[model samples]
Structures are given as C-alpha cells and as structure tokens.
Target: MVDSLAKMVGSLQKDVDKSSRYAFQSDYALFIDQLFYASSASHITYTSLLATKLGIDLSLNRLVCLLYIKDREGMPLADSRLLYALIRTIRTRMTNKNQDIVGLLGTSRIVYCPYAETDFFSREKLENQLQALAATLANTYPVIVSVSVGLYAQHVLEYGQSLRSIPAVVQQNTSNKSGSIIFAEDHLVDYLLQIIPKSVLDHFLGYAVHYLQENPVVYETLQALVCNDMDIYSTATQLQVHRNTVIFRINQIKEVLSLNPLHQDSDRFKVILIYTYARTHLNKEI
Candidate 1:
C-alpha cells in the first residue's frame, strides 16, 4: 500500500508539471500577440518553409500587410475581430524577430516583413508599387494601402498615424471615390484635409447638434463651403444656388452657432469638424 500511494503521488506530480508547461506556452503566445499590434516582432523556422510552399514572395527586410477586406452589406469592411484572428494565424507562420513590427488602425494592419542583408526596393519605388497594387486590390476589395519609409523601427510608428488619416484624405481629395492606397510622405496635406477621427468629431459636434437640427440648411451650406475651401461663389455654383443665397445661409449659420464658419479662423475649423461629423453620422438621420 505504501509503494502504491507513492506511485500515485508521482503520477499526479507529472500531470501537474505537464499542465504548467502547457500554461506557460499559452501565456507566452498571448504576449507575442500583444507585441504584434503594439506595432512591433520573433522566432519560427517555419516562415521560410511556409513561404516556399505558398509561393508568396515573402521578404525579411520589408513586408507590408496591405490589408484587403471586401465590403459586407455595402459598408467599409471593419470586422476587426475576424481579421485579427486571421493575422494571428498568419503570424504563427512567421519567423520574424523582435525588430519586426505590426500596427493596427481601424480595419487595417501594417506588418513589417524582415529578413537578413537584403535591401528591398527604394522608398519611392516601393510607394509606386504599393499604389499600383492598391488600385488592383480595390477591384475586388475595399482596400486602403498605407506605407511608410525609413527603417522598420521608425516606419511602424508613422505607418500607424498614416493609416488613420490617409483613407479619409484620399477619399476627400480624389475622384475615384472608392478605397485607395496612399504613401504617408505624399499626403502630408492631411492637416489641411480636416482628417478628424469619427469618434472625436462626433463628441465635439454633439454640443451644437440642436442648432444644426433646427437649421438644416446651415449644415448643407456649411458642407459646401468647406469642401470648396470656404469660397462662397464656388459653394454657390456647386449648390446651384445664387451666391447671395450662399452668403445668406452663412450669416444665418453664424447667428445660430454664434460664430461665422466662413470668416473666422476658429470657426473654420469648427465648421470642418461639423461637416465631417455630419457626413459620417447625421446624414443617416436625414
């Protein structure tokens, strides 16, 4: 009986050790995942094998995720839950070290594909290639390709900010109107584009929504004016109304909001914020 009890105890200890090992591996995998999106990289020999088997031109020095998710129900694809899981599965196939970075903005992710001693295309050439690739991706997917230059270490940070602002800048400025890829350096004019995040813009506009609701023409008139760079004549031409009509509504908006969105510097910013807010949210209410 003594020998049997000792054997039983040893068996239990072995099982507990095995469980602890499994737990450690699981926890470590979770930490690696946090690193992936913290815009940051690690080890697996499997990356090369998988790339060869898959016939993807995987590179170590530079790789971009170029996320392409097709539309669902006619809205921009924003199913991050599904996409993040897919990314994790893909990461499992990678052998990148800590220097490899990953970044996420909205439904998009930027991943640094790294390798040893091989410099990829120059920055300008890479940007052009990514832009052309973005055009092709847009045919089947609502794509927003954002890329950055400089070392992988610095590039990921810029890539994160660019991904946030580029799609909106391109959509507002370009005629194609669907999603497109843009290089961060090429679109430095995002500051002039009123590239406000939707949530922040919504919160700021909430204070004056009652005024906007009471005077709907003010919203329309404000939108046209800002899109035309605060020009009254251009706004009038675009709205197909007389220049005086545009001027009259601008005055009315000034009275209601207690600021002239057209003339005052602060009000110009406010008007752009409200215009962006309405485009993304309040238009549905109409």
Candidate 2:
C-alpha cells in the first residue's frame, strides 16, 4: 500500500509538470510572435522552428497590420474584455480563420499573413478589407481604431521593420485622422523624404495640399488618381464615384496647384512628389 501511494503521488507530480511545460511553451510562442513583429533578422530560424513546432508556417512571404484601439476621446481601452473582443473580431474578420496568424502586441492586435498574394489578405485586397473592417469595428465596438498596414517590402525581414514604422507613419501620414487605414513606410528612403523642406513643399504644392485637406472628396480623388497611375477610371472605380467626378476633382487639383499629375514633365514631378509629401506629412500646413 505504501509503495502504491508513492507511485500515485509521482504520477500526479509528473502530470503537473507536463501541464506546466505545455503552458510555458504556449506563452513562449506568443512572445515570439510579438517579437517578430519588430524583427529585423533575415529569417528568424528559432522563430520559424518554434512556429513549426506549434504547427505555424513562417516560410512564406509575410505582411503585418497593427490595430491600435482607443476610446472616442482617444484613450486606450482599459477594459480587458474589450481588448480581447477587439482582437478576436479583427482576427476573425481580417484573417482566414484557419490560416492567418494573429497575435497580441502590447495593447495592439497584430494580424500576420505568412501567405503572400492570398485573395483576402494580398497587397491589393488588404486596404479595402481594412477599411471595411475599421467601419465594422467603429459601428460594433463604439471605439475609434486606427489601422497600420505594412506589406511593401523586399525581404521577409523588412516586414518586421515595416511593423515598427506604424507609429511614425501614423503621425506623419494621416495627421491622426481616426479610422484611417494607413500604409506603413516600407523603406528607409522615407528618412530623406521627411527632411524635404516644409518651405519647398509649400512653395510647390502647399495651396493644393491645404485645399485638399479641407476638401476630403477631391483630396481622395487626387489620392486615388496618383496611386492608380493617373487613371481616371481607376480612381473613379476605387472611390465608387462617377468617372466625371474624378475628372472634375483632377481638374480642381490642377487648378489649385497649377501643376498636373497627368503631365509627364517637371510640373508632374512637383505635383506628385509635393502632394504626396504634404498629404502624408504630420502637419497639413507649413
């Protein structure tokens, strides 16, 4: 009887130890996911192996979107339940449910895609998805959420750096425009872009930029036009407006800036470059 009781006790201890180990591994895996959000390594061998051990695949190209949630007055959601629900909603809505990986980074939720060129999560589709998701979140959660999506990259490692660029990009790109889906700066070349003189920027496109700031409709049209290679139809389609509306806005922008993005000359360069910088810069005005 004594021997049997000792054996039973040992078995219970072993089970407890096993459970603890499993829990530790789970926590470690989560930590690694967050770490790689800011990762700069060529490829994280340890993280890859860790992911494999946990049945995750980090071999494919990667993209990350960081969602920062706040109250209507711009305060963090201090309630734990809200944070969990926010993460779950974003993950369920943005990810493939069974495929894409989602993790928590501090108070933010990180949606990571190891599958590049996916139908729902691909570079082309993500912005639309995020914009829709942001609307959904605003309606459902009653909180103001800002989204930073970063996929423009060369190597998988640059993705981590891309994630790190969210804050500065948010500050510069949208002027803290709540509920905006911002694209993260993908390269270090932005450091130089940031140094472009505010005076020079104003000299060329300042009136145009400020005019766009006050007129969201024309501004977005200009935005879509420039991004879509100055295609009126594409800008119209993207904005869900009439082609003539896009054309009218394009003309408005031309009138405001006295330069045309449609032109293939130095005027074109000034409008495109300066408007981009102005639209994305922290201050709307010099």
Model 2 lDDT, residue 171, Cα: 61
Cα deviation at 174, candidate 1, in Å, is 12
Which candidate has the highest TM-score of all?
2
Residue by residue across 170-228, what tens digits does model 1's lDDT show? 44444333334444444333433445555675576775665666667777777788779
* Candidate 2: stretches off by over 4 Å: 1-43, 108-114, 118-124, 152-156, 173-178, 185-286
lDDT of each model, Cα atoms only? 0.50, 0.61
**For candidate 1, what is the total of clashing residue pairs?**
10
lDDT of 2 by residue, 1-286 (tens): 9997567546643443343323444634443453354232322443444455566555555566777777887776676678777767767674555445566566545354435544334555767777777788788986877777765433435556656566556564543445677665442334335555777766755666667778877767767776787887888899998988887877777777676777657666555665566556745543
- What residue pairs are clashing in model 2? none
**Which regions of candidate 1 fall more than 4 Å away from where they truly are?**
1-32, 36-65, 69-127, 133-179, 182-204
